[model samples]
Target: MYIGRFAPSPTGPLHFGSLLAALASFLDARHHQGKWLLRIEDIDPPRSVPAAIHRIPETLSAFGLEWDGEISHQSNHHLRYETALHQLQENQCCYYCTCSRKMVAQRHAGVGYDRFCRTQQHTGGAVRFISSNAELIWHDAIQGKRTHAPASIEDFLLRRRDALWAYHLAVVVDDAAAGITHVVRGYDLIDETAKQILLQQALHYQTPSYAHIPIVTTTNGQKLSKQNLAKPLDLSCVSEQIAAALAFLGHPLPESLLRAAPQAQLRWATEHWSMERIPKRAAMAWPGV
Candidate 1:
C-alpha cells in the first residue's frame, strides 16, 4: 500500500500556495489508490496557532481533499521523537553542540557548521547528526536524479537548542511509523532531503520515495507563505481555487469542468495525475497574485 501525507504546519490558515502541495499529494495518492494522511506539524508551539489547527482541516474539507483515518498531530508524539533521538545517541551517531548561530557564522564565515563541537565534547545544546561520508543519492519522482557528496551535506540538527524536535528527525520518524511509502511535497524542501535520508540510515528506517513539486512564489520571487503575509484561500470559491492549482501543476482542466464542484475537479485530477507533467523549475510565480 502506498501511504502519502500532507503534513502542514498550523502557523496560519491554508492559502493558495499550500493548496498546491495538498492537492498534488492528494491527487497522486488517489491516482495510485493509496491512502492520503494529514498530519498537523505543530511541534513548535510558539509558531503554531490554535485556530489554524481546526481551520486547516476545515479548509481541506471545503476543497474536497478529505484525508484517510484520523489526523495525526506532531505534538502528540513527543515520546516517539525522544525514542528516536535516544537510539541515535546510543549508537553514537549524533553529538550535542553548544555553538550559537553568531559564533558559527563568525568562525565558518556562514558556511555550514564546522563540526567544531563534534570533537570538543560539548553538552546541553542542540543535537547534531553526524554526516555520513558516502554520497547521498536518490531518484526524485519529479525532479529526477539527485546526488550530493558528503562534503556538501552538513551535520544538521536533530534537536533544537529550545528542546523542540527538529523537523528532519520528527518527519523521518513519523513517516516511518505511519508506513508512508511516498512523500510528495514542495520543492523548497528538496534541500532537506539529504539530511532526512541520513537520519533514516542511522536509525535503520526505510526512506520513502520523494517527489518535490514546484513551489508557488510571489511576483517578487518570494515563496508564498504565512511569514510573507500571503492571503488565505477564499472559501467562497473552492472550485475555482482547485482549478487554479491544477492548472499551475500543468494539468489544466477542460473548460466544462471549470465550474464543476470541488469533488468533480479532484476526480478528474486523480484520474489524470502525472508527475512528469509538473514544471521542472524549482519555483514559479503565482500568476495574478
Candidate 2:
C-alpha cells in the first residue's frame, strides 16, 4: 500500500498554509487508496512553541481529517538519525568543518558553502556531506524532470555548530525510515527536493514521488510564513477552510457539498479526491476568503 505524510513544524497555529498542506496530503492519499500519516517535525526545540505543538493535531481533527497509525515525532527518532549519520561518516562521504558563519560568508559572498572544509576537516565545527556525481537530472513523479547546477549548492551543515541535527538531514532520514511513497508539500520546499533526492541516492533509499503545491501567498506575493505573522486559521469556519483548500487544488467542490458542514466537505473530499484536478501552477496568492 502507498503511504504519504504531512509533517509540520510546531512553530505556530494551524494557519491557512498548514491546512492546505494537510488537506492535500490527506486527500491525495485517499485518492490513491493509500494510507496517510502525520508527523510532528519538532526537532528544532527552539522554534517549537506550545500552541504550535499541540494545536496542529487538534486542528486536523477539527477539520475532519484523520491519519493511519501512530504519529511520529522527530525528537523521538534521534537514535535513528545518529545511526544514519554514523553510516555516512563510515563511508567517508561526510566531513567536519569548523568554519564560522562569518568566515564562510566572507569567502563566498553568501553563496553556498565554498568547500573549504571539504578537504580540511575540523573539530568542533559543522558536519557536511559531499555530493554525489549525479544530480540535476532527476524527475519527480508530480513535477517531472528538473535540472540544477551543482555549484549552486555548497556542502551545507548536516549538524550545526550547536550540535543540532539540520533539517536537511533529519527530513530525508525520516521520510525514508517511515516508508513514505509520495510527498505532497508546498512549492517552498521544491528546491529542497534536489538536496533530498541527493541524500536519498547517497543513503541508497528509494526516492518518493514529489508534488509541490502552490503556496498561499499574500497580496504582495509574499509567502504566508511564521515570520510574516500570518493570521491563524479560523476554526470557526471549518467548512469554508476546506472549500478554500479544495479550490486551491483546482478541484471545485461539487454542488452536493455546497451546504454541507466542514466534516461533510472533508468526507466528500476524501471520497472523490482526484490528482488530475490539482492545479499544475507553481504559485498563487491566497484567495483571502
Candidate 3:
C-alpha cells in the first residue's frame, strides 16, 4: 500500500494555508487507499512555538484526520540526520561554506550560490552540499517533466553557520524512515521536490509520486504564510473549513451533506477526487470557495 504524509512545521497553528495542505494530503492518501501519517517538523527548534505543537493534532482531528501509526517528529532523529550528512561528506558531495548572503550577493552577481567555499577545506560554523548541473533535472507526477538552472543555488547549505540540520536533509531522512511512498503538498514546495529527490537518489532511497496542489494566497497575491500573520484555520467551524479546504483542492461537496459526519464526508471526497480537478497552476486565490 502507498504511504503519504502531511508534515507541518510546529512553528505555528493550523492556519488556513496549513489546513489546505492537510486536507489535500488526507484526501490524496485516502483516494489511493494508502496509509496516511503525520509528521511534526520540529527541527527548527528556535522557531518552534510551544503552544503550536500541542495544537496541531487537535486541529487535525477536529477536521477528521486520524493518522496511521505513531506520529513522527524530526527533532527526535538527529542521529539519522548525522548519518546522512556523513554519507554526503564521505562521497565529497558536500563542503563547508563561510560565505554570508552579503558576500554571496557581491560576488555571485546574478547567480545565487557561487560555490566560493566549495573548494575551501574550512571547517566549523557553516556547511554546504554540492549540487551538480544534473540536480536541475527532476520530475513531478502532476507537473510532469521539469528542469531549472541551479546557478542561483549551487552547492547550497545543508547546515547553516548556526549548525542546524537543514530542511533539505531532515525532510529527506524523515520520508525515508517513515516509508512515505507518495507526497502531496502545496505548489510552493513543488520546486523543492527536486532537491529532496536529489537527496533521496544520493542516499539510495526510492522516489515517491508527487502531487503539487495549488497554494492558498492573500488578496495581495502573496502566499499565505506566518510571515504575513495569516490567522490559523478556525477549528470552531471545523466542518465548513474542511469542506472549503476540500473544494479548494477541487473536491467540492454537496451543500446538503457539507455538515454531515466527518467520516462520511471524507468517504464521499475519496470516491470523487480528481487530479485533473486539481488546478495545474501555482499560487491560487480562492476568493470565497
Model 2 ranges off by over 4 Å: none
Candidate 1 wrongly placed segments (more than 4 Å): none
Rank ordering of all candidates by lDDT, starting from the highest: 1, 2, 3
lDDT of 3: 0.82
lDDT of 2 by residue, 111-212 (tens): 677888887857557789787544477665555677887566457678887889999899999999989999999888888888888778788999998887
After superposing all C-alphas onto the true structure, candidate 1 shows an RMSD in angstroms of 1.0
Model 2, residue 12: C-alpha shift (Å): 0.7
Q: What's the TM-score of each model vs. the native? A: 0.98, 0.95, 0.94
lDDT of 3 by residue, 161-197 (tens): 8888899899989899888898988888976777787
Q: Return the candidate ranking by TM-score, descending.
A: 1, 2, 3
Clashing pairs in 2: none
- Best candidate per TM-score, number? 1
Worst 10 residues of 2 by lDDT: 133-142
